[model samples]
Target: MDINDLRSAVTLVSLLLFAGIAAWAWRPRNQAAFEDAARLPFSDEQGGQS
Candidate 1:
């Protein structure tokens, strides 16, 4: 019921919401796009020479 308690509750809620969204976003069909995007930076960093 204090400011500290309110802050902790907000942080916990935010983390849970983020986890839910992340799980939904990474569902099988969406996962391939996410994986491709995730690898893009690494590929670019390696000069994309492969």
Candidate 2:
């Protein structure tokens, strides 16, 4: 009802939304690019050897 309450509610909603998005993004079907990126440093290291 007050400004402080409104601010708290908005903050809680945004936090929940961000958590949901993070969970969706971490699902297995969406992880291949993330895995590839995780491996990129190693790939670059190998490329530098040759």
Best candidate, TM-score-wise? 2
Number of the top-ranking candidate, with lDDT as the measure = 2
Q: Please write out the lDDT profile of model 2 over residues 1-50, one tens digit for every residue.
A: 99999999999999999999999988998799788988877875555644
Tell me each candidate's RMSD, in Å, in order. 4.2, 2.9
Which 10-residue span in candidate 2 carries the lowest summed lDDT?
A: 41-50
Candidate 1 lDDT by residue in tens digits, 1-50: 99999999999999999999989997898978888998876775656556
After superposition, the stretches of candidate 1 with alpha carbons farther than 4 Å from their true spots are 29-50
TM-score of each prediction: 0.57, 0.59
Reference-based lDDT, residue 34, model 2: 88
| Residue 23, model 2: Cα distance from true site in angstroms | 0.4
